[model samples]
Target: MRIRQRCGERARKRADRGPSGLSLLPWLLMGLGALSHLLGGQAPNPWIGAAGLLAFNTVYIAIVFRAFDRSRRESPLTWGLLVTLGLLTFGLAIGYGREWLLLFPLLGLGVGAVVRRGRLLPLIAFPLVVAVGAVTFWRDGWGSIGIVYGTFISIMVTAAILALDETVRELRETREELARAAVEKERLRFSRDLHDLLGHTLSVIVVKSEVVRRLAPRDLDAALAQVADIESVGRQALTEIREAVTGYREGSLATELDRARDALSTAGIEPVVRRSGPLLAPQTEALLSWVVRESATNAVRHSGASRCEIALSGSADRVRLTVTDDGRGPADGTPGSGLRGLRERVAAAGGTLDSGPAPRGGFRVTAELPVEASVPPEGDPAR
Candidate 1:
């Protein structure tokens, strides 16, 4: 059973890989009749006949082997060799009609291997077929269709199969490329989600834990409230991380703003939020929530701000969110991964994200979105 299965696997692989040079080599057996006549010593000019037979075999092997390589098959030298082989076939077939005429089909195999699908194919095939038919009729005195028909079939079938194999190889390559691109895209999404979820959640826990320590020395009830808030934040972080992993997470701006207020207040920065104008699409809300999460996290983590403000203004066509802090200004270097990921998310929704040092003092991050930002289909990461 094992031996049979392995044989079947090998056969499948060969079918996929298309024809090799060795596959055509077996057809050379057709020349055996001429070889027998030469060996038996019945024909005239026997020395020259042996040499001509040797030359024919050598040329045929070279043409068929080179045909398997695309560059060699299309070379000018291959065409030159093919033309030379055609002349040999005509000379032998016309000179010695009986067994040597089999060389015409061998010549047809050579022509099939060299010519690709184009005007050149029919141009070469038409005259070759017509000439072989005429020569066979003149010499064999009629009822000689077998050799002519074999030549035509050899040329056409070989070309058609090789053409199909080329197309199959190209389609296989294109599918592999698409699969790789999708894997990379999903990797980017998972990394961005983990960063946003952990970054803000950890910062909030740190700030409120400090507040609990300080207030415990003065007020028991207040300190316990802070600890309870810590538990709630931790549980919410767990749920959000689960959704992010499965690529089904959705965001609400109102929920994010409430969390931002608590995060900023616990960090000892006053939080002032203002909003006005039309309801937004789910995708637009999702993008704005990321902006708020990233901005509030940055204010708590980097800025020495005493107060931070988040503002949202919307019209029929567009909605914009801006976060500003009265603190030390944007961090000195390049934007971190959070800001970069948020920028990509916003841009994918037909929007923009910008962060820089505020003109008045501190830092500001701004995001704008089209009101009609379409929700990604279920289970797909937003764009």
Candidate 2:
């Protein structure tokens, strides 16, 4: 929410200022000398001069006012108006020759506001420079060199400033977009982690709780041992929930196998674990551990099986894990959210996850992963 507010405030600030017709309006004062010349009525046909002055102001106003809006600035109509402004500028300068020549700089301002690309700029700028140089030199001699230089400088400077302002605004908007995406991604990760953690942990707790209930009458000491196991599971659940919330939990393959063995035994299912090949990287183990945890929990909670097998094997660059159980199989013949989440994780690590009824009348889950999985950084809390 704070991020959204900050983004709104920045957008408002960007909107409130920058390249606008009103900013260019102050430069209209530059033409006041021409206005003064006309008002004084010192030279040439007064009515024609007045008409040219009025036309220049109108076109200049039209070009500048529309230049601040992106759609209007890039329109064919704006270019046509700009061309008319150019023709009027040259007409006034060539016709009046003295005070009227000041419109060249105003034309430069309008051109700078609209023309953004360097490639296209020369197409317009070069001809204007040439025309202004030829006319100013013809009318005012070498002393008017200042007018030509000022016109070019005005175009380049204004273009650079407005272009830079546009760039800054784009960068700010891009940054806000990235920040929002990151926040959303983190929220998704947290939700998935919480689900995976609580699902497996609670299943084990419930299984052990039932074991305590059954053993309490027959053997008090055995019931107390199961109660102690429940206490240990609860403590571990608290730690895992903390890690999940903080996004810093890492899992170990050996530790998960131990938990899976205990969990399956508590649920009265025999667990058989097999492993081969070299020791794997922690990242690869962490992902494989999630597979083991999810599969074992499903076996306990849903699969009414007497035996479950978890087999892990790896080569130089790849690893595989297969968990199978002699059970009735998924009632819907499809995986639950836990398996779906596991598929997303494995796929992100450049791996594959498959779950279905095995050919031999039981449920099976097979996961194949690269030896060094491309997992985002999060590891076992103990590590």
Candidate 3:
């Protein structure tokens, strides 16, 4: 599968080169036809010389038809008929007189204008036709130095027009690529935001609903409180989703710690928090906040734990967080959705998170984040 994909990519790149390659074909045909004319002049038999010139013109006309067909704007059969007409004109040029040869280049220009239909085509073809006509007139004893000067001007104009066409094509392609990249970036950003907003809210709602089911017949007030907590959680989830959509979502370590405390207290588990960290980068802080929330949640929902601890410490270069709970670890022998999301968030921030059973008799989670202060030296002592 991988090999096939690589081959397909190479083919696409080769196809993208077609436009520039086709642009060079007309000039190559003209150069080769001119060479054939010169060589025919040296042939021993006049008939053989004429036949050689006819063959060269025929091949050039065939090439023009193929170029038009590849463009797909014109019908291949129509261009093929045009090629036939061009061949007849070449024959008439030879039979009528040598002066009639001047018409061939002009005919080529007319065919180019019809088939190419681009602004650059006329600009390139017009001058070449006039120059060929002037050269033929000079050969027939109607020459002037002004005709040669005009030919040089024609060549320069043709080159300038083609250069402009190439520049416009490059600019259009660059704009398309940039637009595609922006769309992809926005898609990824939204996906991450949705995950962050909905995952924990849904998990908490499920846990509370289960608890309310067990306590409803025994204690009506306790069931009502659980229902209220569910409503509050739902509202908070809606607010976070709105903020995420509006690019206004922000998180802090202190706020997450408070929530963690409340969750543990409600679960009848003692939660101990120890902090000794400098201010964290926004990305690191947000990620650590999510970690704290997920750890506390899993401790309540999955583990039958009596105690939990969350510890945070940081210096100038590195920060570490550890969450431990004394519980019967991982009942089903599979990690839950909360743990999976926590793993992804930490990994994305260039940090690591490990969660498994503690050898003594519980579950343990540890995370580390690296931070770099972006302030320049002596920028401001107090800002």
What clash pairs does model 2 have?
A: 249-379, 250-379, 250-380
| Model 3 vs. true fold: TM | 0.58
Measured against the true structure, the TM-scores of the candidates, in listed sequence, are 0.85, 0.90, 0.58
The residue-by-residue lDDT of candidate 1 on 1-383, one tens digit each, is: 99999999999887667777787888888898888887887667778778887888888889988998889988988888898898888877777677887888889888887784678889988888999999988877566688889898888877777767777877877887888877887787888888889999999999999999999999999999999999999999999999998888888889999999989989999999999879998778887888899999999999989999999998999998999998875567467888987887777777888988888988889988889775333212332
Alpha-carbon lDDT of model 3: 0.64
Off by over 4 Å in 3: 1-58, 61-185, 214-219, 328-348, 359-361, 372-383
State each model's CA lDDT, in order: 0.85, 0.86, 0.64
- Window of ten residues with lowest summed lDDT in model 2: 374-383
Candidate 1 error regions (>4 Å)? 1-18, 40-44, 374-383
Worst 10 residues of 1 by lDDT: 374-383
lDDT of 3 by residue, 120-215 (tens): 556745665565555446454454343334433433443454445546666768988988977665565566556545756776787778879989
Q: Over the stretch 231-325, how does candidate 2's per-residue lDDT look in tens digits?
A: 99999999988877877778889999999999999999999999997788888888888889989999999999999999999899999999999
By lDDT, who's the top model here?
2
Q: Tell me each candidate's RMSD, in Å, in order.
A: 3.4, 3.4, 11.6
lDDT of 1: 0.85
